[model samples]
Structure formats: structure tokens, C-alpha cells
Target: MTSKSGRRVLVADDDEAVRRVVHRHLEDAGYRVESVPSGVEALARLRGAERPDALVTDLQMPGLDGLALLMEAKRLDPALPAIVITAHGSVETAVDAMRKGAYDYVEKPFHKDVLLLTIERALLHRMVLEENLRLTEALAREFSLGNLVGGCAAMQEVFRLAGRAAPTEAPILLLGESGTGKELLARALHYNSARAGKPFVTVNVAAIPESLVESELFGVVKGAFTGAVASRTGLFQQADGGTLFLDEIGEMRIDLQAKLLRTLESGDFRPVGSEREEHADVRIIAATNRDLGTAVEDGAFRRDLYHRIAVVVLRIPPLRDRIEDLPLLLRHFLGKLGAAGLEISSDAMKHLADWHWPGNVRELENELRRAILLRGSTGSIQPGDLSPEIQAGRPPRGRGDGRLDLRAIEIPDEGLNLSDLEREVISKALQKTGGNQTRAAALVGITRQTLIYRMEKHGLK
Candidate 1:
């Protein structure tokens, strides 16, 4: 017998001998057993603060019979597992108890081993239900809109639009640069909508080969093509009554776009090599980094198909466009990567904020992960810890006058340390003028005396 030392079981029967025998058997099997002489007492135990993990009760008790007791226990805690004990020939009563939510049934004149095994199975069922509920709640919190992490106006607008469109069934079109979190937003929409309990399926149009794209989306019957051995369910059926997110939708072949358009319009699709048309009520959310309007004009995409899926369009801004959210993004990624305690040096943060992230949020997360690894025993991140491309910051943009444009500098909403800014400006000016204090002061548009005073105040050479 497996050691069930911590599990509690409640035994209820009108026969005092049966209750005593069951209590002793379960205690011998390492269960913390509670014995009650009647069904009414079992119901009282279930309503107590310390409810039992599993209940084993007799079906033919005099008052408040086992069926009624089982129903009340379930009402108190729907996940509580119960086992019914019926007379040897009372199979119908046992089946009725099962239909009303008993986990399993044990016939009277039952072997002690059989009763113990039934209780074990019921406890196991309770455990599985608890675990599934835990996972579902975790996913709900992880995909909640409040977890998206954004403070910039552009990002806030994206959040607003997504919230407004999430509960609707209208097909959505997500347009953004690569790595701008189109798939993440799609998941948030699905998990927050009416179809949260159903599956949220995803397919990358650009990743699949052109030859298999059609079958991949609409499924294939056995022997539909060469090397076909069994039927395959496609994304549409898999995401039935939920969501189907197509990433990089612009990469789909023009010929296949017509078929996709037909399914979107009529909710009917035929599997390959099958004459019968199957229907799936799937909500489509398609994303693309490419400009579909331009693709339509260039004959690279079907204009009619484009019109079908663009019911609600969302444009996720790139990282460079929403640099104000960098601090929040950094904190979010750090917490997620289990490096929340690590600090970022001012110089390192400046480089991160200045870089024009071509790969957007995904790339930023990768860079931070790499920095944490390279930081070794250090508790903080420095510029040297980052990738060479990031450490270089953004390349300088020059004007016709050949002077750097200080006006273009982006100040984060939280602002910066004025002393740090002054020191950096003085140091750069001195470097440009080759350590000549007079020319450096002139370049900085400050008097030589004031520049020297400020340089001394900042402890700059």
C-alpha cells in the first residue's frame, strides 16, 4: 500500500460495526480516518473547518441518506471526491450516486482492500481537479491585460484598443514590426474574451512551406497526399469556438488566400481529399509585419481577402517609438527572468534607451538575458555587460552644419540627474576640443570660468 500519511478520509455508516471496521482499516493504511455513525454526522463533518479529503458513506442509511449527504457535500465544495457504499445487489443505487457526482462506488460486503483502493482513487481525482484549477488561474493572471506593462501614450492607446475589441467576435488584424509582441497581444485578447476556456491556437504563415500551408490550416484526410497514413486535424478545428492566431499572415501564398477567405466568410472548409465540408466556429486574429495594403497594390496579396480579416486593426508600436516604457519593461522582464534583484548602471540604461531596437521588445528581452548571464558575480549591469551593438547606442544623426543636434535627445518622463547630464556634456565637449578648456567652454555655450567651476564641482579633469 502507498503511504497516504497526510490524507484524511471520512467514513459514514448507520451500522456501528461497519464504521468501526472501516475506521480501523483506513488507519492501518496510513490515512487519517474520521468515523461517523450516521449520514447526518458525516454532513456535519463536511461542513466543519477541517473538511476531509475524501468521503466514504453508506447509501441505505435511515435519515439524511448517503445520496442527500453526497449532494450537500458537493454543494459545499464541488471538487470534493465522494465514494458511495451500497448493498451487494443495489447496483442501480450506486450508479445513481455516481451520476449525481460520486467519484466511485463500493458495494457492501466489500473487501477492505477494495474500499481502500476506491478512496485512494477518489483522492487522486480530487488532486487532479485542484491542479487543473491552479494552472487555469495562473494562466488567467499571466494573460490579464493588467500584466502587459506599458506607460507610453502609444502603448496605452494600443492597450485601450485591444481591451475594446477583445470581447467582440470581429476578426482582428495586428500590424507591427517583427518582435513587437503581436502573438502576446493575441493571447491576451483570447484569454480575456468569452472563449477563455477554449484553446488558443497559433500558426506562423511564414514558417510553414508553401506546399503544405493549405493542409496545415484546413487538415487532411488519410491518404490525402503522398506519405499520408492517418487523418490530421488542422488549426481551425483545433481552435473551434476559441481563437486561431495566424502570425506573418502576409507571407501566405495568394492562391491559398482565396481558400482562407472562403472559410472566414462561410465558416466552412473541406479537408484535403474529402468531399464533405466541415464547419468550425473559430475566431481569427491575423498578424503581419509586412504592409498588406502595399502587398495588395503589388499583387502579392489578395485585396478581397485583406478586406475580410481587417475588421479591427491594431498597430503595436516599436520599442524605439515607446522608449518611455523602458524602465517598466526592464522591471517586467527582470522579474520574469528571475533576476529582479539585479541593478542597471546609469550608463548601461542610457545605452539601452538610445538604441533603435530593430527587433523591438523581444530583442530587448534577449539582450537583458544575455547581460544577466555575462554579469557573473556582479549585482549590477554595466555597458560592457551588454552586446556590442547595444553598447554602441544609436548612430549619430548629422545635419548639414556638421554639428550634433542636442535638441533631438529624448528625455524620459521620469527625467534625469542634472549633475550627471552636466558632467557628461562637459566631458564630451572636452574630448571633442582635444582637452582645450577654452574651446570646450565655447562649444558648450558657457563661460570658461563657469565651465571650469562646474567641471571642478563634478570632479572632472
Candidate 2:
């Protein structure tokens, strides 16, 4: 089985038999378990270069107790899940553990199955909660730039930029093609930045009309224009201390660009009819699917404002450039959809991964969702289940086959061939590593189920 922790666990229990039992059980469960006698040694392991995903410790250890370890663990990483095992009548210590964020505790004589299940569930729950917190923290990461989606060296650079840009107050300029996720990156930048708590205001410059743009942006004073009966504020004022994203800046009217520049420069604006100036503290981020340099040369954009907003410029690659990410994205999306009870077939997935998605990720997701519904079963989704449009966009042959295809990646020909591969790989890797999917995936440079699918594929009993 694959380790839910994906890392080692530190077990601090003085009982020799109990220690051996835990070490063997967790090791069988695919965790690299390190058992130690005292809380002091466990704390030493944690504070040193070696870190555990979770800690299972017994209360009332000599000198340094489990309660002290819990405090230190919380200080190190608050989300680190801990399971406290205690002797009976230690109700006070158990209650204290919960109050200080020890996830939950089990009695000293806890069953082996109970301990393993508790550890697995606690770790998985912690992972989900951390992911949510990260999502909330990363609202400003400009996901468009990082959309390439691979752990490849080239892809790491893109992710690095996204991480750095997520927390800044500076305006981020995303330059990319129409299908390259410029807007997604813009949203990431907002969610991960200082203004993440505030609203992210977006305006498509190309979508608005030149005549009504001024009134739309600055709002109208009472009797400011033909339809102006009352006063109102605009999007810029509404986005104070937050982010205002202007997409397709090249298409903005030059006159309107001047007013926008004024607001960016001095944070001051006046209603269409009002002579008084109102101040707005808004951070401006801009995106364009076109060449802004060419637009600037042609006098379609002001050079000064371009420098102000382009303080952080990120160029996103097209889907064709980072096609290696297709498989990982495939696994992530398929796993997610499967959890939601939609089983996508390998052939259908092959068609998807091999296709030239001109519409990029958005198109791939739509097709997969449609395939799920069309199949109308929790069983596998096959090539026949896909829309004709997806089948038509297939990439060149051998695109989906990697170097380790035989062991980690499955090929869907027809009939029951796909599951055959899955079963074969899972069975062999389990046998070879004694049922450890995590190490097998590492050996193959792919995921655990990828190996499992091959085990089932080849029927390697």
C-alpha cells in the first residue's frame, strides 16, 4: 500500500513490545517508522535535519514528556498531526492534548487496527486542511504562469516565480496567449498577495465601449450626464486597498488610459461632473494576450504606465511547450473525478493526453466532465465515451508512452486490457517491494496507482 504520509513517522514509546509492534505495523503500511525510547530522543530527531510527517508518542515519559513534545511540534508546524497514546485514568492529559492541538488520543492498550486507521485518517485530514489554507494563502500566485504543471526543472522555475509573486503588493503583468491562463494567474496573484483578503476587481478593457467607458469607470455625479440623476462611485474606488485587474490593456482607449494612469499615479479621481478629487488606494495588476510592446510602439498604449504596472512581468508558456505536465494533470484530475464517483477510462484519458488542446486546460476539463456524464457509470470511461472533438485532437503516436511505461503507465487497447495492466503492475510492485507502493512509484518515477495499474495490466501474480 502507498503511505498516506508519504514520509516517515517518529514513534516515541518506552514499552519494548509496543514499540516493535508499532514499527512493524506502520512499516507494513508503507511508512518508514522510527521508534525511540524517550520523548527527548524523539524531540532530537524532530529538531535535527530529520523530520517526521506525524508523531505518535506515549504520555508521561521521563524528563521530557509527550505534552512538551506536543507543544514543540505545534511550534514547529501547527498543522503537524499527533496521536497521543496514554494509560487509563489519564483523562486530564488527554483533554490537555486536544486543547493544545494534539489531534486525538488512543488508550495505551489500543488495538493495532485502531492505531493504524487513526494515524492514516489523521494524516490525510491534515493534508486536506493544509491544502485549503495554502489555497487561501496563494490567491495571488498568478496560476496562469504556473499552469505548465510539471515537476520538471523548467516547470519548477515557473512555480518558483508564482510563489515569489504571490505575496507582493506590486502590480504583476502577465503576458501570454489567449488560452495560456493569464486570468488564472492574475487570480492566483490576488489570492496569494497582501490584498488577498480584499476583493479582486477585474475589467476587460476590450469588452467595454469607448463612449460609456469613462462613466463606467469613474461613475457619474448628480446630473453629471444625460442619465446621471444621482451620484455613485466606480470599480476603482470599490477596490481600494485591493487589486484592480485590467485585462487586454492594449485595447483600452488612449484617453481612458490617461485617466487610468492618473489614478495609478496619485490614487486620485473625480466623478464625470465633480470638480472634487477622491482618493483610492488600489493596487493595479494588468494582463494582455497580445504584444503590449508592439501596441506601445504603435501609440496604442502609454510607455509610462506600462513601466508602472509591469514591475513584475511573467510570461506563460503555451500548452505545446510543457506537454509533459499532461500526464500529471491527467492523474490529478482523474483521481479527483474518481473520488467524485466518475471513473475515466484509460483510452479516454489517452485521447485526452495525446490531443492538441488549443483551448488548453479549460477544454480538457470540459471534455473529461462530459465523458464522465456520458458514461453514466462509476465504472471505467472508454474512448467511445468521449466527445468527437476530443478524439479529433489526438497528438502524435507515442506521445503518451514514457520510458517507464511498462511498469508505471498503462496503455488501453480495448476490451479488459487496461485493468489487466493495472492489476499486473500493482501485484508485482507489491510483491517486489513486499507491497510498498510508495517506494515502487519512486523507483519507476511515477505515482503508486500508476504502478498498481501496471500490476493489474500484466496480471503479475
Candidate 3:
């Protein structure tokens, strides 16, 4: 739908003079323009399919007040960018309008470029958001429901919920502890969705800077900022026909939370510096390690945004909780690591089966790779070749002093789940050493290859 040209512009102001001024200014700036006197007229025009890329409306109008009109326009298409005109220092109203879904606000009597700049940024922002979702859905892995990895009953339930929820168009939120593979669940949802072939964009909301997160997600035109030397697209636009994964979304700043809520509702946004609206067909998949409910109660996160993004909540359990599949996981990792063709010593194997791994699958992989690396040119791994920490009967992890890394487990005298216990040990040991399988193996007095083998055996990852 993109052509080598400018974007659509909608002007809604009762002041004929102001409308004419804005219309001419935007047209001269290389945009197609349509002007209406009031919000009601703007809505009628939009409903008629004369959708504009952006709308510039005055706060006060004869009918369908600007705020109400803006809300209605968004209801028509959240992607339709808009800017509100307000009196100077009336930022409180502008902020309220933003909370109500306006793209941005411009004080009355501002320079033409100021208004133009706001619209440009808004349009570009929408473009990037769509693009981000486009990439995410298009590039998502083919993760079937059965391929969710764990066989534990808890995981099985998770898989079931994920599969059941995949086909729907509603937003999905995945909640879990750190390192619990929330992103994987999100990818699974996208890949299994109807828009699987489109883009699938991921934005670690916590990772992006507060100052730049908007432009980075929405898109930015040339000179949108001090360092923006050229035009750039945001994640939203890139994910136009796909899914957008907002990871660690709970970490986003409070100010940006309102903007996100509007976009989630409207599905459109502008770039960093443009007076145009960018459209996209996007789905959202948000994941977080923090408890959003708590954050909302604490006033750290917006309530509206939470409800918008959490239509379908999937909880990812920690590795320790599902230890029954340790063996399966260990074998999977071992095969992937190419650690086959090596004989395992019963002594080493037992040691691995008994140790605690804290790093989860990632940690297990580290330990296994380290062990394999120790195999040298001969590719023959031996327990004696293990790292000194492991050889000294310490966890593969580095020690600063007295960190309670792995707590040795006491196999119950009456009864205990052997498979589960072994996986827990493997997970803890790995976590202690930060997933250094080789060192972990050595500390447990086994070869790194043996650790991998054990991780595989236990499905510990």
C-alpha cells in the first residue's frame, strides 16, 4: 500500500481561517489534505471511507467536542493519528486528552512547524509500531502447541491454554519468573496465529530508553531529534501485519504507558516527526517478569493498559517446578550440542543426576558446552579435564565469598520424585555457576559432557 509519495491529512477546526492555514501548510509540506469544520463532520468523513493519515482538531468545536471526536475517530481506527489544539499551559487538558487517546497536543498560537512537527512524529510513530509487529509475526518460529517443550502436567496445561488461545485476535500476556521463557511463549502464540506469515516484532520495553522509546517504536523522520540524521521506521510499522511482543512491559515508564494504551486500542500511530497517520494490521503479545496487578495497585503501571494487553494471560512455570521432563530436555540439549559419541562413566553420571542446577536450561547448556569445549582436539571428554571449581567439589559458578547458591537436597527417606529431584539439582548447580555446565560438572565431580548428558536425561532445560 506504500507508494513513493506523501501521506493523508485530515483537518478539523471550526475556525475556517485556521483550517485553511493548516490545510495549505500541510499541502505545501507534500501531503494530501481534507478539511472539516467540526469533530462530527470529521467522523462522518472518516466513516465514509475518506480516512486521513492524520487529524488536527481544535479542542473547542460546535459539536462532538474535540476530545469526544478524537475518541470516536480512534474507535474507527486507532491508527488514525491526531493532534489536539489547546490554550497555553492547559497541558493538564492535553494530558487528559492523551489519556483519552489523542496522539499529541499542541498549545494554541504555536508556530506552524511546531504543529507540523507534532503530526509528523505522531504519524511516524504509528508507522514504526506497525512495522515492529510486521517483523515479529513474519519471522516467528513454527512453534506448534505440542512443541512447547515441557511434559510436566503444569506445562501441559500451559500448552493447552496457549493452543486454545492462539487462533483468537485478542492480545495475549505471558507472565513468569525470570528465565522462564516468556518470549518463547509469545513467539509460539504469534507463529500459531492466523497472521503467522506476516512480521513479528519484539521490543523489550524496559531496554529501550524512556526518551527514545516512542520514536524507536513509532518511527522517526529525518531530523526528528538531535541525532536523528535521517528518517527511521519504528517497530509498530515494521510489524504491520503481524504481532508485536512488548517484553518487560511492566518496566515501561508511567508517561509512556498512556500512549501505549491508546495504540493498543486503535492499532495506529505516527512516527517521531510527521503530521501523517500510518496504518497497520497488528496484534500484541506482552510478557513480563513482574506482576502487573501489583504494579497497577502500586500505581506504577496504568490500569487501562493492563486490561488492554492482558486479554489472554498465560503463565509460564519455572524449570524447577516441572522436573519430570528433565531427561527429555537433557537429551534434546545434548543432541543439539553434538555431545554424542562419548562414553559416560557411572560415577560421573550419578554425580550429575544428584547435583542442583539453578540456571535452568540456559545454565545447563552452558555447563554442557563447557564440558564439550574441554574435550580439546581429541573430542574425548573426561571428568579429570573438568574445571578446577568443579574438581574442588564446588558449583561451576564463580564464588565471591558465601553466596548460598545451591542448597544440597536431602533425598527423602520415605519417598521422593527422583526425576524431579535430579532436575532441581541440575538446575540449581547450573544457576550457581551461572550455567557453566563444565564447571558445574566438575564441581559435582563429573565431566561437562556428562553434565549435558544429565541435563538431557533430565530434560533440565
Candidate 4:
């Protein structure tokens, strides 16, 4: 076989003749080979300078056996694939080797071709594992608290609240629009908390039909109902000792809400068909864009459950309310798209900032991604590159009368978001009144305390 140079394989066996033959075969296969007399020597080499791509160790060694060596090798590099060379024809030993995470195994009298193939497979497995690690690390860094891009006061406060809530096991209620990144924040909370290494299961209450909501959350037994052929584990059990994020939780039926409340209060739930109660140690984090407070008052949601899941509430400001972060978010998306060097024209930036992002950050990201794909190799983005809705959102050619003309305001076909419109009007009122809170409150026909709360909610000065 032609040598595969630069690929290193470490061989550990007490037999000198075996080592010599194996070394010769690997070297001829274009691999750099290192032979060690025992598992201890192999470990020292692995820990010392260079690391091998794969290990070939004998099942029986003097000081450390092949199984022990494999465990240590995994501790050093979990991605490293190892092959066990077992001279013994014992099936138990082979099973033990496999149990200890052996990539592949060969008998002592194995053919050279078989050994070479096993080594090649091990190397390929290692490469895949390394690539997965790189991607996982990249994603972790991308969503890390420090890496989340936003400098506006509202965003800063959100970050602060998330940081404080991360280390605790309290249920967090995330309030925001559909595309406002509630799930991302839920993940951040999970990965930052003590449950970081545990499962982070999600259930979109709105997506599931009302009939299946309970079964999906609480699992089912064999013959639980029609089409129930086998016992099934529910999301609650799957998220045991971790986090369970219920998205659009307000859409859950009131009857299901009571069952969910029971789970939250006691961590106990019964499957749809089973009379026995099971326990799951899961931390709940519920999110919704609807006014859950109103839902509770309207008898659409259970009042007790509302208060139970909302141990720590975080209201994510809509994109329009925190428009100051638009530039940063645009740049963030550009960087994520591998277009960090691309610049947006001032007019384009203004257009992006001025438009009410009903879909919030998700929409912004999609727009940037679409823009990048559509405008290939373009040096920069201009106003015309934006969507028609964004372009038409700009205030029309003014009367030039210097006087404020509401008639010139151009509303898009999607119509104005009443919440956004109200926020902007209040903001403009505050701006026009030179930061006089009382006068601004009076002009908006709201109580001073109500105005103060709105200002704080919008993160306005």
C-alpha cells in the first residue's frame, strides 16, 4: 500500500515482533508510525508533544490494559478513535473493548489489509468529530451573552436580566413578538445555567393541535388511546433535570394550562392513559407574544398558572422600540453572512431603522441574508436594494413647508402596527416636550405614572 504521510498512528503493545510488523505496514501505508512498549509509554507520548490521529493498542498489556488506555485517550481527546488488537479470541474481551469506546478492533493474526482499512476508518471518524466540535463551538460563541450584538439601553437591560436569571432555576417568562428571538433567549438561559450540559427541549404550544397538547407534554402509555401501540416518553421526561421551553404558551387550552400548572407546582404529571403519576425535574420557561394578562382575565388562561410560570418576567422590546440597535444588528448579520466588509449606504440604514420590524430580528436577519444572496459581489448595499415595503416606508417628498405634515406620512400596504404607532407617537411627544415627563404624559392623555412606565418599557430617557 502507498504511504499516507502526515497521518500519525500510535501502536502500543508489549510484543516487539508485533510492533515491528505493524510499524512497517503503517509506514508503508504512507503514515508516520510510533511504537510504544506499553500503555504507560503510549499515554506519555500522547500527553507529551504530538498527538496521534488513531491508536492501536493490544488488549493485554503489563501495566495498563488496552481498555484503560482507551479511556485515558478519550479523556485527553474524546474525538480520538482507537483500535484494539486483541490476540485473545474471547468475545467478552471484544465486547469490553467496544464498550470502552473502541473505534475498531483487529485480531492478532489479522491481515495487513484489514488493519489498514480499520485505521483509515478511524481517521475518517476523528475528522468528522473534529469538524462537529468546531461547528458547535462556533454556534456557542455566536449566541454567547457577550457576543449578542445590541448596545441600546433596552437591550442592555435585557442582557442584564438574562445574566441574572441564567444561574437560577426560576421559571422565566419571555414576552415578545413572534420573531423577536424568544427561543434564542431561552437557549441562552439554558446554556448559561447549571443545566447547560443537560437537555433543552422545546414545545410550540400553538403548533400542536389542542387534542395532542397534553399527550405531547405528558407522554402516553401503551394502548393509551387510538393508534397508541407503544409507550412514549413525553417532552417533560425528556427535559428532566434540564429546561422545558413552552413557546406561545398562551395558546394552550385552559384545561391543559391547569395540568401544566400542576406540573409546575409539583413536578408531577400523569400520562394521558396512565393513572400513575410520574415526576420530572424540569425547569419551565414559557414565552408568548400575546397579552397573557388579558388572557387570564378573559378566562382563556388560568390565573394561577400565569403567575406560576412568570417567576421572572422579561419583556423583550420590539425592534422598532430599540431602533438604535438596527445598525449594530445589521452589521452583526453581515458578519454572520461572511460579508463583514460590506457597507450599507446611509440611506439604506435610515430606511432599515425607520421601518417597523413587525417580524423583529428574525425578519432583519432574513432581509440581510436575502440582500446578500441577491446582490452577489456587490461592494455595498444601496437604498434601492431594500424591499419595496421598506422603500415605501420613508416619509414622502415633504410639502417643504417646514411645518409638520401628517399627510406626508406613507403607510405601507401591511398597515401600521398600532402598538408601534402608539410608541412612536409617545416618543415624538416626549421629544417635542424637551424631556418633560409630566407635560408629555398630559399631551398623550395618560397618567404620569402610566407615561413613566411606558417610557421605561421603551427604554426612553
> Which predicted model would earn the best lDDT?
1
lDDT of 4 by residue, 1-461 (tens): 32367988999999999999999999998899999999999999889778988899998899988889999999998888899988756657977888879987898788999999999888887787777667656655665778777799988999999999988989999998768889999988887788765678999886786688888999999898888899999999999998999998876766787888889999999998999999999999999877777556546677899889999999998888888888889888998899899999888888888787767899899988877777645688887787777788843342121235679999999898977777897899889889876567546544344565567667777
Pairs with backbone N, CA or C atoms under 3 Å apart (clashes), candidate 1: none
Total backbone clashes of model 1? 0
- Residue 396 in model 3: shift from native, Å? 7.4
- Listed in order, each prediction's TM-score against the native is 0.67, 0.52, 0.53, 0.63
**Residue ranges of candidate 3 with Cα displaced over 4 Å:** 1-142, 340-356, 376-461
Q: lDDT scores for all predictions?
A: 0.86, 0.74, 0.76, 0.83
Residue 96 displacement in candidate 4 (angstroms) = 5.3
When 3 and 4 are scored with lDDT, the better candidate is: 4
Question: Candidate 4, 334: how far from true, in Å?
Answer: 6.3
* lDDT digits (tens) for residues 1-461 of candidate 1: 33498898999999898888889999998999998888889999999999998888999888899999999999999999999888888999899999999999987788998988888878877887888778767777899988898998888888999999999998999998878999999999998888877789999986787789988999999999996699999899999998999998877776788899999999999988889999999999999876778667656678898888998999998888899999999999999999898899999999999888877899899999999988856679999999876776544343111235779999999999988988999999999999987668657654344566678778998
Q: Estimate, for each residue in 1-461, the C-alpha lDDT of model 2 and write its tens digit.
A: 32555677889988888889888989888888899999889988888787888899888788789999899988987878899988989978888998998988988777889998888888887878777767655643434335435665655775688779768777778876556667766777777676776777888865776666777677778898777788888888888888888887766666777898888889999878989888888888798766667556646577888888898888876665677777676665666566454556777767866766766666666766777667754577788887765677643453431234348755457546655554555566567777665556444444333344445546553
Q: Is candidate 1 or candidate 4 better by TM-score?
A: 1
Residues 1-461, candidate 3, lDDT per residue (tens digit)? 23315688888899898889888888887789889898888889889855777788888888688889888988988877789988787889888999988989988787888977887898887787678766654455446565667888888888898889999999999987656778878878888889787777899875666789899788999987899999998899999888999988876767778877877788778888888978767899998766677667656678888898888898877665666666666666667787766544555444444444455566556766777777555445555555455455556445422234456746577888877876787888899889876457545543343466678777876
